[model samples]
Target chain A: MTVKQLTLPELTEACVRLGVPGVGLWREPVRAYGTEAAAKLVHDAGLAVTTLCRGGFLTAIDPAARADALDDNRAAIDEAVTLGTDTLVLVSGGLPPGSRDLHGARERIADALAVLAPYAGERGVRLAIEPLHPMYASDRCVVSTLDQALDLAERFPVEQVGVVVDTYHLWWDDRAPAAIVRAGDRIHSFQLADWTTPLPAGVLNGRGLIGDGVIDLRAWRERVDAAGYQGPIEVELFNDTLWVRDGVELLTDVAERYVRHAL
Target chain B: MTVKQLTLPELTEACVRLGVPGVGLWREPVRAYGTEAAAKLVHDAGLAVTTLCRGGFLTAIDPAARADALDDNRAAIDEAVTLGTDTLVLVSGGLPPGSRDLHGARERIADALAVLAPYAGERGVRLAIEPLHPMYASDRCVVSTLDQALDLAERFPVEQVGVVVDTYHLWWDDRAPAAIVRAGDRIHSFQLADWTTPLPAGVLNGRGLIGDGVIDLRAWRERVDAAGYQGPIEVELFNDTLWVRDGVELLTDVAERYVRHAL
Candidate 1:
């Protein structure tokens, strides 16, 4: 829900009117609209802010960049608390520019978590480490597997930090089902986005909608359910093709697809 | 090298003149040049055929397709023996069309191996399962990690089956170093290719030349060496940008970069 279709306020209104009880949100839009105002809009409309989009990119090798990311993530956690969302999704940033140190980048994720976890716990927000697809391993997120995310999350209290189980990211891993089972109460957020091919230039916005691609979403849903995750399943399609569609129509179609394919 | 780079005879001449002891050949070019003639060209030049590019795509769900793949792989095994290469690299094909069955696809690789391993072992051609980068999981290859390849390889007798450790395909995995150590004698082939971002449209030709990107190639070499491997380090760059350059010049640059970065 970052750009393309509707504003955050508009999306909130649409979600509430459409009886979508829970809505996940990105930070910048909420910031632009004023976080308190955005929070009030969803809160008054009787919608729960399921999760704040992200709070971690703590893998930057640069001191200034690293400091900036931590500051922004702290603000994101505060915003999450303000919006009444218990979950704050963190996309651990990828290999820092011109750096081949994946291990170092991953260690930085742990270092940042050590600092942010207590702050997040204080705010009653769970840091949900979202493992992006392996394609994003070099640029977007180094956390490329559910097992890796789970390993990182287990280092902290489950209430303070947890792992995100997104079908688009984790479906390719054979160990994902078992990892999901092991996640148990550590599974703070579950997202559904199908894997589509001929990934566009940059490969970032090529995700398919719930039933549009080959992922067995119902199987993933069942796996998560078996792990004791009784939460709103979010349909998070970041496709350039789907971005052009009318928001209401897209939401309606996705809601129906979610029922048929993901449930 | 594939056809985009060199004619077999010309590549053999370049290898001989450049003092490069071995060269990897692809199936299509070998078939085109006549496997016997391609064998003669490299053999006469005293160049060891490090590996035949590929021999498996056995994940096709169609019975006919699967049978054809096995038959073709058998032919590839014969070709590998003719070319005097012990390794026949297997890029395990991706999910069958319109299917999300990665586990099933992977199982097909094992099934195919059960048939091909004995066939290969008899001919002294070890089946090397090469895991392509996970970006290829949807369409190109399902085996996307060293451990996944190792899992399949470990199922077969060590002499008949083994794993390929490619730095480009494997560097991002936090477990890759340990996987390489665990690979031990099972590592049949080791390749060096750097990962460059802003991955082009198809993403196939987006590989960076060894030193030009951020993969710690020397580290991977050390890991493989620690695992008791002292083999030809094939510098397999698939960059469209590098492809258009003069073959001799590209080879020279790659050789120099390989020494500087990968050794």
Candidate 2:
């Protein structure tokens, strides 16, 4: 089954056809097609929404702007609720402009989460903190390791807060396997992607499509499985080159790679 | 003193004049003047050579080429020995090209060290494994944390194996203080620099000139001092902007910043 091109509808349908149990959808697509419409499309296609791509950027210079982010995250929780996506992944924002204090920015993220967690809980959406790669430590995400994420999680109840363990971010971590075991059932989602060469812009464009880069996907999967996480493993690639290609072709390649390597 | 501009000679003389303690000299400068001449120049100027800026790239596809790296490192150790420097800093090379196995590459680094350690020891040069920031994990250095460096060091005697604790690579680490303590006397050298906003290349060229960036230099110095390391703290800045300025001006600025913020 070679997929060539796919829109949201076709992508959803193809997941079912390919026997993929769930799909992790990003915010742009959800916003573009309208959350309700996308939800209906997924439901009609008999596909489960595994996780929402993100909902956090709580670091900002302006207090009002930070509050605005919180409000927007509340809206994201509502959208996740409407889509029946239980996990809302949060990529904590980095330090604001004219500020080099990462520790302070982290505190702000925790404070914002303290406010948003209750709102997310009210909507039955679990807040899953995704610790991005340390490369993103300055400008993108302050939380850069699973241990750091787990440390943050300790501050909240397991039912209200969990963590998204993406292999791309945590694979190089020396304590990764142990951290996963420590996370146990609190591992809200497992994201799969390989580390590619020449990280573009050192941030956004460098994610490798599964099985294409250096990550030992099988080892990561085995560790996660051993940690007792029975949740769906979502293959999330942020490759600009792949996105430029046909979506169906990309999806087909992703599915095939998953079968051969990830599964 | 408000340092604005001064020549390289003036910079070198100032180190002597002020009894600046230690300086990590780059290869180009030393090579241009020739190793013997450069050693005499520094000795005449009464300066202490702390550590050579680098010596590692052992991960190469060809075995002969990889062996060449050890040869180069041997030359560097000779240079360090001639200059009266005891510690030779090693930035463990990243994964080889067309390779995805980071663990394999790390093993290759350990192997390289095992081959070179005896020669370095004979020359009375201690190899200090400087774990670069995790951002350099792919193209530069695989050792990304103090703990990782410590793990590598445990394989050898403390006098033979040491770690360079650079603030830029380690400030974000939650276990930094503990790692510093664990490092104890094996902490070969201490390097200081700040992490500024708007990171250039998302990794390189973003280091702050001491007080200009967000790191708590004084606090870090206190931690290292408390750990019983009374060595000279070298200020290593990879800032292109700073390099474009007069060398003497940069040195004076560094001295003032060290006294004001780092001491």
Candidate 3:
């Protein structure tokens, strides 16, 4: 939700001026800029749209909401295709309100993927299922581990449904390292952010700059490399403190930490 | 950290007055009250010390700190025996500051447990390893799931080391229900607290009253009971908001929620 005011043209120009190679576009801003224009802006600057910010929440218990989620996700896939991004990140929704059926919610995510994976595969767009941190397992996303994501991913073709490895969401999990290795080529997108303490209220915008938190970025990077993942490593930080700073400065800060901690 | 003000006598008296069968005792307050005196207070009041909180931080990398942890844990075991509690809660500490070796930290816990188990076993105390939520995996505890806690507990005799089934920590995990059944007789202590979102600044004081949040405490209680755990189902809530209130009213509230939600 950072950079809410920055225009698409300004962001793309800043990327070019700052020598940043690529950018991840969210559905809201890309749609605001017109997906085709956003695609052209990044492409004209010779930058890659690393991954589109989302399309899941397909675990709704309401019949109407479930159908809407499917339609919305299909639309999100079309937008990803238009933006020239192969990765459409899916944050599967959490348990329905007042329901503690975690098993049922997880099953809904898997079933949603079974339907959407084929839709994405035909368009050459991959559905990258992102396992959010366990803290968000109730309200945000129920897919809370790489192991869980891979378990769901393995159910589909490797080219269609894949897992996303984000340090901020997964660094705390001891199983993450082995899961990264086991993921192999199923890792659709790799993102970097750090985990900091005293997580803010809502706990959404507390992601730290790479070296500022406790994540072993270098170790995770090495493990991913060992897995033969030759993909773009996106430095995606959703930080409250950094969001208030100049976007260009934040980008520079991320790039600097990328070299210092994650190389 | 809740209920920091009430003295041991006052706490035990409150328990007796409120018809509360038992209370969870922390090491700091118990030590402050003089373990023998505190034990006598609870024992005379016919109150069971459900669990003595905690005796860990055994993940130290330095030799001296590690040795100190072991010594402290040994003393903690002796205190639990004095307090008339068979269960000694152990919150395995997180990564050593500035160290990202999660695997190393976990192994250190196992090593510490291997040493502590036999010592505890001799004294008729069970080391109940509590897997905190993953949000606390950095600074508080490396063990973050029932499965992981069981993996560590299985290495020792069931009488020497067992797992604590706390709803606040394990509710979000989809595998938790099965892990409960898998734990079977090794479930030493079962605690209840609900998972609430917008987790406080440090994410420590966010545990909700039994039914105040999203956890299916009744279901968890059922699962633990099904696992053949006929032990004290401790209602442990660590809410900052509740701590400032009158202890009697809070105890009354907890007692009410325990029946409506946990029973």
Winning model by TM-score:
1
Q: Given the true complex, what DockQ would model 1 score?
A: 0.71
| Candidate 3 whole-model C-alpha lDDT, 0 to 1 | 0.88
DockQ sort, best first: 3, 1, 2
Instruction: Kindly list the per-residue Cα lDDT of model 3 for residues A72-91, writing each as its tens digit.
Output: 99999999999898999999
Q: What's the CA error at residue A81 for candidate 1, in Å?
A: 2.0
Over the stretch A165-257, how does candidate 1's per-residue lDDT look in tens digits?
998888878888989988999999989988888888888888888787878999989999988999778888788888898887888888878
lDDT of 1 at A9: 67
In candidate 1, how many Å is residue A70 off?
1.9
DockQ of each: 0.71, 0.37, 0.75
- Which candidate model has the greater TM-score, 1 or 2? 1
Worst ten in a row by lDDT for model 3 chain B: B1-10
**Can you write out model 2's per-residue Cα lDDT over A1-263, one digit (the tens) per residue?**
12223568888877887788778877777888899999999988888999987898988869799879998898889889989999999998877876767778888888888998888887888899999987677678889899888877767877778999998898777787899999998899998888866666445766788877777899899999999999899887776778778776678778889989888
Each candidate: what lDDT?
0.87, 0.81, 0.88
Clash pairs (backbone) in predicted model 1: none
Docking class of 3: medium
- For model 2, how does the per-residue alpha-carbon lDDT over B1-263 read when each residue is reduced to its tens digit? 11223433565687876669656776656776688877877777778787886788877768898879989999888888887889989988887777767777877888888888888888888999999987787778888889988988877777677999999998778787999999999999999988775566445666788887667788889999999998878888777778777776677778878899887
Docking class of 2: acceptable
